[model samples]
Target: MMDALERVTGPANATPGAASSAIAPVLAGPPQPVRVLAAFPAAVYLEHATGLLAVVAADGVQHPNAVVLSVGVAARPLAGLHVGQEGTVGDGAIGVGQLQVTVARWFDPSPHLRATSPPLIAGKIADARAHLMARTGSDSHDLAVPADAVAEALRSGDMDGVLTAVRDLVGAGPGLTPAGDDVLAGLFAAVVTLSPAVAPEATTTLTRTLALTGGAVVDRARHVTTAVSAELLHHAVRGEVADLAAAVLHAFTGRRPLTPALDALLAVGATSGRDLAHGLITGAALVLATAEAGDPDRPATTVGAR
Candidate 1:
């Protein structure tokens, strides 16, 4: 299903040559044709021979493995494309079936949450949770049990507990990006990206912990989730996320307003936005707990206490 951003972007008459001068650097090597894995009104998922996934979005929302088309590109043409249709990506343009889109921009989707006092970070997280609950009118969802287990494990620094809960969460719900997988993606991205910022003093320990848990997530995800979701989880483990998810993280770091950024995220898929939000809040809370665990002076905190 198309997300809110895709629906809003809609279709436009594409002038592919108009932005020729502004095209960013193309991917390395000779162009290779990719198979369409899925096509939507404003987005197309493609698979390369190497098994890597790439997304082409008309809305210009960036992902680590995505190509943002120029605003002039017509999204309607993408909807007509079928899975397994041939496409070629290189030289700043993507040609799929009868549709072609010029690349206008590229970005690294990995989030960088700025370092701040733990108290300030905690307050930002609290505000995010409150805003989410107010918007959704609920603090928990269908996968709350496993989700809470993951958060609790993180809070107590129990790697074994985390892995056990993660096994239950992956591929547990419906959708191309299952609700459970979305939660895990959000959790992995938040924890991997925000840990160092919240606990600079514990960087070594955090890094090691992330490596072990992140590797486990990637390995298990491939076997349990859809190809698209598994790929997303792999990226999330490395701290890369969709633009909306990144916006929420940025807001938590005081880089943007919490309500608007979070509201935009909450508008995504049926429950994807809320599930990701829950995971983000859980992951943020975990950061605070982990940081406090390494520092005796910091006050104790529990996961999901909010």
Candidate 2:
């Protein structure tokens, strides 16, 4: 090896005793895709006989086990290694080793995954509904309405019933202000779009559920918000809605009301929501904007229609 000065110094400035020495490492082949586990702290090797080692080596989450092959980790991906191939994902590995044990670490589930515990008052969905209901008592008969009635209103197309029942539950006391703006934001979750004519019913179910579940409402809301937001960012702006966004919209709006949002959606010039479901989210946003624009009594779909 060259001396310290010879290595650090430029080739031209090499000392008389030391020969000019400057070497750089060469890059290997093209980048290869490596499988990574996101759930746990460490990665479980994709043992062939053993199957997908735990995606996450360690985690509170109950780990899903993989199937084992006869020989061992397949020489290459052999014997249909798709069974236990799910979990969080991260970067690829550097070099290759026998398909014995792969390594992995926990992929941070931040903005992607909603926080489960200590729900965000506004940021989380389920919690917002509860908060909103708590502030606004049920509007049904003074007698506590049966859960069946609540479920029925939601399950059947009883928008008016749901609104009236929930109104009774909330009672004449004070209004149930959602804990924060998060409540509205969280509405993105557990929401399905309906035909424009049926939007009132969808919102009715939505408001009722929020008041009832208390805790679950916020959690679900977070999930909805995240799912919908992601879809919008990727697909809607481009054009069509992504799978998740489409699903959420369908679920939240129901059949009757989403028609206008759908019409609005088809009208815009954009690509598909493959990257993100931006279009569907746009439809949802328009719903809110329309609601805010006027007629607290009027449904969001009516504005889109106009």
Candidate 3:
């Protein structure tokens, strides 16, 4: 039987303060996390390549929203089964404290996935490219050089080289969370989907790269990009062909503005939306470039190749 742990709505030590002007707006949205607590037991399942999907029980009750955990690693033993779990908050355990949560649902294809098709994917790629071209004149594109270098390093199995290229790309874009980081995150996700076997090593390199490029700003961008990219990659891993394609496609084509998932990424910062859009386009370009190169062990083609 699962252990019954008491659920504290917020931090055990927290007292509800009278709403004040300064703190009101920050608290306007969904509830925020409080104190750090012990790791409570949870039920874990694989959300395909997305990462761990965990339903932790608080007071032995299930939560409607399962926490989607993203770790850049290959498949684990829990790939398709439900099992008891416990882990640190930094690893994607969501709660105020050591709140126990139970899995309410896992990987339900978003309704948005239905709109995807090959032509849509192709069209979005074209549209995103055109958008970049229009934005910067002549389609020279954003992050083209570094993205290509990272892809080449991946194909060549040079994890260190990949890390260097990623750091350089992410370090230089505009905004608090440079747009390049988001695109790099997307590119990372695509590579993970196209080659699941490489994730463990790739993740190792990525973790180290992020460490070397440390800063409060970059860290924030990393957090948002990692989450967004993991979701996209997980959809691809599950063969949710339409939804996976739709996520990026919509970001570029915009028949619909931003999907709920993407919107969350955007809300991370002031310029997150614009940066994410640029990232999506650039990420797609990287994927197209690699796919067209036709060699898993060679440098990726340039965005202009197609």
Best by TM-score: 1
Local accuracy of candidate 2 as per-residue lDDT tens digits, 1-306: 223222222223211111101101000112233343222222233322211223221211111122122222322223223423422211122222222222121121111222111111112223222332343342111222222233345444465554444333222222111111111222222222321322443345343443444333333333433322222222111222222334434433332233343333333222221111222232343334333334465442321121
Distance from true location, Cα of 166 in model 2, Å: 24
Worst 10 residues of 1 by lDDT: 1-10
**Backbone collision count in every prediction?**
0, 77, 9
Q: Give per-residue CA lDDT, model 3, range 38-62, as digits (tens).
A: 1323333223221323332222212
Q: Which parts of model 1 are misplaced by more than 4 Å?
A: 1-26, 72-77, 90-93, 102-104, 154-159
Q: What is the alpha-carbon lDDT of model 3 when measured against the actual structure?
A: 0.38
User: If scored against the real structure, what TM-score would every candidate get?
Assistant: 0.84, 0.20, 0.41
lDDT of 1 at 120: 82
Pull out the clashing pairs in model 3.
55-101, 55-102, 55-103, 56-101, 56-102, 57-100, 57-101, 57-102, 58-100
Better of 1 and 2 by lDDT: 1
Top-down lDDT ranking:
1, 3, 2
Candidate 2 stretches with Cα past 4 Å from truth are 1-81, 84-279, 293-306
Residue-pair clash count for candidate 3: 9
In order, the Cα lDDT scores of the candidates are 0.71, 0.27, 0.38
Ordered from best to worst TM-score, the candidate numbers read 1, 3, 2
